[model samples]
Target: MAQTDLVPAARAPVLAAERLAVDGQYLTFSLQGEIFGLEILRVREIIGYTQPTEIPLMPAFVHGVINLRGSVVPVIDLAQRLGRGATELKARTCIVIVEVDAADSAQPMGILVDAVDSVLDIGADAIEPAPAFGSGMRAQFIRGMARREQGFIVLLEVGHVFALDELAALARGVETAEAQA
Candidate 1:
């Protein structure tokens, strides 16, 4: 599918933030050799690798639900959701549990990642506007790029990544693909 079909516009508002106002602590992690960061405020907890129950009629990226302390939380394969293939399961692979703004409520979700990096306090000056094109990701996927000594860590807007509306669209895409197959 084309990139636009993947980056649903319904999710854009989730991570939309101004460069100057985007400064905050972020939790960084790796996905397909790329470093990405999520606003620390959105992260609820980090847990060890575990398989989640697969759901029918859902996108492959929707790895399915896991019982978290009694509550069922949906886990998303962050790599696949971003257009990269599903993450290769490994010792370092783990889930980053996050809470995203869903309409008026805060919905909890899990983000599967290759490995957990570290939490960093990124200043406003360190943030640069997302490039218009050729970032290997949609402009909305990135909140901003944080300048680092090694390079730039793409700051991901977690809410947009897990927006209910966008995810529903992605699920529909999966169904379409399966039907064609």
Candidate 2:
């Protein structure tokens, strides 16, 4: 089967208020020896790492864009985005296509990971609220911490990770200024 076909078609169920309140299933992946997860709902597809045509003046984390079915989607390196050491693109590296919802629009974005892990069915009971201190990552970027058989998985807030609002606003502002010029 094709990679697109392997992507989960149906989204997992949202937790009810009465339930433990975890978001949904997560597609766990590794980066710099740490395990991190992204909400499976936002995941569109996963493809092996391929060199992307570099674009200038963008953020350091922005690895450039790729052509998926003719739609250009920007890719961000999760390792660099998380402030971890830079990752050497290898055979195991893969790009995870995520759909981030911007404040003004709903558009999908892609994130590159060192390696894609397994899909974990973590429920509310298994999750603990993110710690305020001692987490190397910014608190805003984290959703929660999940306990797993191997160890702990840092659940990432995919929307916040890309800071879609800030990026979209910046893009809009540039357009507006260009129009005014």
Candidate 3:
């Protein structure tokens, strides 16, 4: 199927809220060695590693685009994007398909994760504002820190992680690369 045929279906579910409580359930996953979470509602699906079609002139962090059914979804290495080095693909590694709400539309993107952990119900009492320092990833990408077990899981702000400006630049890069090719 053509990509335009797939765009609407891909963006529809990402904006709906499925939770009823003030506390949010987060789908946690590992990047490098640290754990991170995305509000469960933001995630669309998880697929095993599939090499994406390389798009030239794109950022080092961008793994390139994937033909998800029919839609061309950009896949990003979460670790590399955050300057933590590239993620080593393993049998357990998966591309987390997420719907990131953008200024013009709800954009569908893929985030490569080392491994997916269990979903945790982190209530408001257990969630704290992101610390100014010490967190491994950029502060802007972090939504908050959830206290769990003996440590913290950085909650990712999906919208910021897959910001439109960054993606638009990547799209431009694709065009530039194609032109030069």
**Top model by lDDT, which number?**
1
Ranked by lDDT, the better of candidates 1 and 3 is: 1
Cα lDDT listed for each candidate? 0.86, 0.78, 0.82
- Ordering by lDDT: 1, 3, 2
Worst 10 residues of 2 by lDDT: 10-19
Model 2 agreement with the true structure over 95-140: per-residue lDDT tens digits: 9998888767767677888899899788888887778798888876
Residue pairs in collision within model 3: none
> Model 2, residue 46: what's the lDDT?
94
What are the models' TM-scores? 0.84, 0.79, 0.80
What is candidate 3's lDDT per residue for 48-75, written digit by digit as tens? 9999998777788889899999999999
Residue pairs that clash (backbone atoms under 3 angstroms), model 1: none
Question: Model 2 residue 133 lDDT?
Answer: 92
Error (Å) of candidate 3 at residue 128 is: 1.1
Which candidate number maximizes TM-score? 1
Candidate 3 wrong stretches, greater than 4 Å: 1-22, 170-181
What is candidate 1's lDDT per residue for 77-146, written digit by digit as tens? 9988888899999999999999988888888899999999999999988888788888877666788889
